[model samples]
Target: MTRKLLLVLLFLMAVEMNAQKGESNFSLGFNYGFGSEFSNRNYMFTNQFYKVQLYYRLKETKHFQYQILVQPEINFAEHQLLNFYFVKPDTPNYQQKRDEFTRLKDIREYVLNCGFLVRKPIGKTCSFYVLGSIGPMITDTETERMSKGFAFADVLAVGFAASYDKFKFDIRPSVRHVSNAGLGSSNAGYNTKNIEFGISCQL
Candidate 1:
């Protein structure tokens, strides 16, 4: 897991350097979640999800801009985000809260995804936007039964961004979905509601 995280970070740094030249803009963002009510469970703060991303601009107009990004995320505590099954309340595999906590204690997920963003500025320096992207994701797990280790993913997001000189800041709300794309029997998938906000600069 450490190696995976390290490699992702390195990749982000490389992208950062690449974005500094020509017409490209460099963006970095951090996001977290408040969970969701899904088929499996009522999510909570304990079902933590956080993401860090680096983006490079692709195109822009006075009110619209497009970009691409690579995101690295961590999902911890609530085991639901890491699993491939659609859990029901009365399932035979149900466990007490303590047991659930115990099982999730050691579980940590490291995920990487490539994505795209389409932003529209409301003002010269501030704007609202929508984003969508699909990519592949992998998780760290001892058992393949929980997940296939690799999956197809997608995200839908809306956000706002503002700039000051060469610096920029933004916030976003997003719904991220992931599925093994039928690679596993328990391919019900996972969905997370997230708020991603951050800063960027044009060079």
Candidate 2:
């Protein structure tokens, strides 16, 4: 009788360990948000952009976890003025200016970023975290005949995240500030402000 009881206990322990190993708590989600970008010479509001993320957490101690995020965004503006400058060798006002056609054009851009995220769990299903990342960005721009080349845009972003979870639904909000590394003119300076909301679930 004692031998039968011991065998039963061993079997139960093995089954529990296997169940934990097979548990699924990983998730992938999407983000939608709005923000604005400003340069030394130009400023504009960005339209809504899309974000994709992959996350993983431990079943026992959810405190330590990591995530990877990718984002492709768009910026919009109208009636933006482009300033022109000219330099003459012998004149007091070496820089001349031209006020030509004033029309609206949409600047197309693509961004690829990878972020490393760390989280600390709060209650039964809540956590606070922070992320740091850097990536490459490209912009399509139109220039006059005497122009040198197309403008380039560099991007870097860092921020914090807060997550609340109930059952299978999760709501995550993040705030970040991005620094634009000038890609075109020598004096080009760029910066942007951003706030994003993310939603995800486990399947």
lDDT per model, in order?
Answer: 0.63, 0.46
- Model 2 alpha-carbon drift over 4 Å, by segment: 1-21, 24-26, 38-42, 56-63, 72-104, 142-189
Candidate 2 per-residue lDDT, tens place, 124-164, comes to 56666666655554445432211223333343443334445
lDDT of 1 by residue, 6-104 (tens): 587667667767866654466666666545434443222234567766677878876678888777777663452344232444655544422352344
Clashes of each: 0, 0
Candidate 1: RMSD over Cα atoms? 5.6
The predictions' CA RMSDs to the true structure, in order, are 5.6, 13.4
Worst 10 residues of 2 by lDDT: 143-152
